[model samples]
Target: MTATGAGQAYGIEALNVWCGLARLTAADLFAGRGLDPERLDNLMMSERSIGLPIEDPVTNAVNAARPLIEALPPEERARIELVVTSTESGVDYSKSLTSYVHKYLGLNRHCRLIEVKQACFGATAAVQTAVGYLASGISPGAKALVIATDVAVVDEKAEYSEPAAGHGAAAMLLSDRPRVLAMDLGAFGNYSYETLDSARPSPRFDIADVDRSLFAYLDCLKNAYADYAARVTDVDFTRDFDHLVMHTPFAGLVKAGHRKMMREQGVTGPRIDEDFARRVAPSLIYPGAVGNLCSGSVYLALASLLDSGVVTAPSRVGLFSYGSGCSSEFFSGIVDEQSAATVAEQGIGKRLEARARITFDEYLAVLEHNLECLVPVENRTVDPAEWEPLLDRVGDRPEILTFTGVKDYHRQYAWR
Candidate 1:
């Protein structure tokens, strides 16, 4: 199908997110951990998706992409020549996560399968890479699937990072049908440097320097946009785009980033507040509800904006993505009137509501096994029955991809 809006050719065709079936309210988490309640407002999170022992990055990727793949006609699905999985939660050193995802998704064997790692920015990088390939005439009328998947590894020891780190995946289809966001090809910018602001040094441990990460994030936001403005002409931070979306580690940082940008453009006082309300606030709802989705964060932000009922017209949108270790990009796209409704039809809100909310004690029960999900093992098995408390919450939902066990170092999975 030819995309009907925003100078179409290549962009997101369909989108979906899968966050497993468990969730925990940040307020409850704060209370249980003895974290100061007053500081909760700074993170602006309501709840976060919890990764259970039966769920991992692989399960997350497959679950997110299954619906999108299942919805396509045979011809369209067959044309999906690339599958790129971006993640910080890889299960193996040599075998890319895309291999397992590709197996479960049952894509055409002729397709290319790959994985990416640049921390939270990996998904954006995956999106751009897919776009580049589709745009390249190397394959005519082709399609690609990009999934940003991750699992939460932090606990109370990681402190605030524990609540802010969410688990799930965002899957998107890219083709000539730019019905969602018609990416402004070539109008992009980049910034990067070696910094240990945050790092997952092991499958079971995460180290973060709050001060360093904060400074790096804010610093990258400024330089990345500056690079974009330097490359693209006739752009105004305040006047050019109808909305703004950014990689939201926490919703408050988005507020801070937008405020910084507005100030750079001499947009002060009430105008900044007014502009933010109209453009940015709509994007924060999902991020706040789900915490940071890692590489999936920005896409969730986009979904929040589209489903927020603020999109009544085709409008330009500015997007920024930053990853720790650190890479950043500033880019944009256009979304027409049809985009919002298309997203709404996906029932994102309904799915979010369906997630089972568990208590702090239940969270504690699953914590140990959850972190062991990625540790390499030659022989191991995960009993779904052990995860019944969390799984029972979404038991009514049919056909969920699950991790069963491993045989001879190869991971095994099944649909429950």
Candidate 2:
């Protein structure tokens, strides 16, 4: 009895996503720090990194969601009753990122706009919250928009964690008649606690005690998986689930977490390695390419799996989500029949290919500009004549929300 045919009423309908990566290689990241190449290779196991120049969390969210929102039938798009954005990279303290997303998407004015924050777990929380809202029947037949967006800022000086830093965002639509995947509402488990293993006390910097954070991640995975195992009673991570997706802070940690989870389910040694190589490792393609997406990592992994064509109707896909400071959840969702068909039609690969690559020097300049933007200066205004030509250098991608500049102590953005 797998969680395959549970007849879920609410689940993901479509996933519209975008990743803004400036083309700097992992070698470039290490070279910037004057670090050992071999060590960086082992830690990150990633080939490329992405950089964002004028894109903030808001623009990232808009770029991620706009395509899908526009593809929605006029009626389906109009029925959107809620917008939830989850990010630790939020630009505004009082105003939720949803305000920008709502306005840019031209969503109905009556939609509820809220943001969720709990380190990397915020997006998963937002997704679960959306599911709950749908279940509440407050707005039956209306859909919910949930976006997990973040830009992992790189501090080249920080050798231990900088290589894996990446910037990306994912937007998902949830409703009862999901065209993507139908979640098993009953097969869910969650765990949370307080720990300072990782944090971004400063908006631009991420401080992590690497060892402690990995330990906390493993602990959260253990507790959440235990809770899920107890509830399902018949799940075999190697057999019952077609794919296993986890929040990838980096590639190595995900491999370690997969081994640990397999060992606990009474599978170990060669068998654990085998299952991970086949079932789990495939999900890492996107992360392995794009690097860490902060809150967007897990869903990005899911999108990678969907693109792989291995998941099909009735296949159970297990997901383990972790957020440092710290929380975790273990859940499984069944693939709907239309999921693979929908995924095949998606433009994720095309978008990734279309991103403009920047040189190592260019990447550094972008970061420096972001750092400069951080120091608030009162009454600082940009003359459009002076900045527009510079902003145009970032390329003109259609429908992409570009961070124009700041005026009156407010950050400004416009669509490209």
Candidate 3:
């Protein structure tokens, strides 16, 4: 009963996705570490299951949201006033992806749907907006579902890109009363002029370029810490929060930022380092292992943290969301003890552990797959076990189910 009362507020529930990591069998990553040929075959099969267009990050996100929304109770589902989709991958220039999701999910025709575009910070912005909507008294039993999903496909030939490319999605149900925690919207962080260059072009379609050097990233963290320190005078930075959730593009980057912030602020304590290691560090390992999922990356990390029991009710949680247009936001929330146990039991850990790992070669094959085709042929076979029949059609109309194997060296799809 810490501040938000005994009823549920905003909370995240189930998450589902098709990622590069989900393509391999358990033996691939855990047992053989991607060496077994059988595991590789399975990986190839998985890549061929969804079809070429499904290989992209945005498609994975959009597909994942469909079932999640469908699973909600009618009453709860109807209460959703908005559907916010955060993504960097978009094929449409004019229409918002949220509109597509809205139509696909068969949501209330009058509900507001929007796509937020602040790089990785988009979902966080959506979450903040949901909180405001709840506070504003728009509808009784009002709720908002924020979905973040992405597929990070990196070019193997790229020098700077990590081999850990992946794809996944997460869904959060936001409301008032008896939930994870009451969100505390605090002051926003400022961006530095030098940080603007972080988003440079790369051979890989998924990864973004970091503008600052290691030192510069640290310097930005120091600036962020200073900004936070100036606003909140009462809470102890180290002990107040159970864990600090960070925007982790990579594991080492977050650790480096934390060390720099602690050093510059002259705040040295065992609790700080302990918190950084035991809580913060582990929270980010999912991203390191799975590659960056763009907008979905941070929320995926948050789900991992909650799953591991590193975060609990009544504990304060600090969240740092950074988007490489170089904007960042620092906020905190207090977990509600009532629903903490329930929400934490949502089984995100099992889902993460259940992912399949593909080899570097298979990943390359997946990346090379072509998506812009109207017809399918027998030569389109990539993997027999994984491919689904596709329908060929004219214009933007839904095509007929034709060829059934992998095309363009990628997976093929079949409609139900």
Candidate 4:
């Protein structure tokens, strides 16, 4: 059965998203170690060596969500109904990182909080859940906060998954008023097996064959889209959306999926007009630069379009989210006016432009540093001159302190 809903009063209002590199480009990695640049150069030229930037997923999630929380009027902040975080970057196996986020961001103490795990589609699920909550009249006039974050770590030993991976984060604030668009959820399907561990390592921790994973993904895409088409009605797939925002694990896959969808739906000629190119032009393919952030990838792209002004209120946006092991969903929504303006004015575009590009060697250094042993101590002092106040920490953690850092990890902050 298909799930469908329409509402002019509920939609996404504003999104504060951020992308960054904790270190440098991957090309610099070989240079820093005095390794042969010839091999690296050849790799880059062949399209196999393009490396995405590395950022701490936790930090990115926190950073992206901070602005949204801070921008909320004080009265609204106190009434937040939910905080949903989607990630593949949880710090510990047992802990729900959302709890830490709630504590750090000073969200309402009464908030209903949870984490979502469905590969890259987790946040989309959260968005759908928020809609259901609103539809059920559970949180009247209250807002739902959704955040997606991940650091794509390429498995060096894997040949196929390397080129397409990256890292990044995105955040969205959904409320009942000032609705931007109507959301309709379509066919959902999942393919599972006891032995499929291609996208991730097995519990015993062995890398499954990359080719097997790729083939499975292709098959899953075909199946999911076919199901979605058969199920959706009253919307012409070809003419309705000016854009199709597919969950991109890599740049090429998105194109493949779009082509497949068009071919299957029998769309052609003027019907396929310039809107296709214009809509897809702003496609957010951060994974090529940020790696695969799992749940955050698709939403990050949506935020990118909103932040860049490619999408405005009343625009119909098509979103396709996929999760490996494996589930897929196709959904569409319209943008709201005030939300669009708030997003445009929030300076997200500026923040993305302000990021510093690092060399491969530098990125490796940061990763190594992060992985390396550090002196453990409590009550670390942050340089007030370096850190800026991103959020007001509430509750019983030692009094909060502010410090400066590169807005996206160029600098470091320690709570004093």
Evaluated with TM-score, which candidate comes out highest? Answer: 1
Of candidate 2, the 10-residue stretch with the lowest lDDT total is 382-391
Clashes of each: 0, 3, 17, 26
Q: Please, what is the whole-model Cα lDDT of each candidate in the order they appear?
A: 0.89, 0.77, 0.54, 0.57
Colliding pairs, model 2: 21-50, 22-50, 22-51
- Cα deviation in Å at residue 148, candidate 4? 1.2
lDDT of 2 by residue, 216-275 (tens): 999988889778877876866667777888998787898888888777779867998788
lDDT (tens digit, per residue) of candidate 3 on 43-104: 21112111233344334555556555666788878888878888665434455657655655
Model 3 per-residue lDDT at 401: 21
State the lDDT of candidate 4 residue by residue for 61-173, as single tens digits: 66677777887789988878889888755544555667767876877789888888776667878987887787678657788888887654443444444434554578878
> Which runs of model 3 end up more than 4 angstroms from their true locations?
1-53, 66-68, 186-220, 268-273, 336-346, 370-416
Better of 1 and 4 by TM-score: 1
Candidate 2's error at 229, in angstroms? 1.6
TM-score of each: 0.97, 0.92, 0.73, 0.75
Q: lDDT rank, highest first?
A: 1, 2, 4, 3
Q: Residue 223 CA error for candidate 4 (Å)? A: 3.5
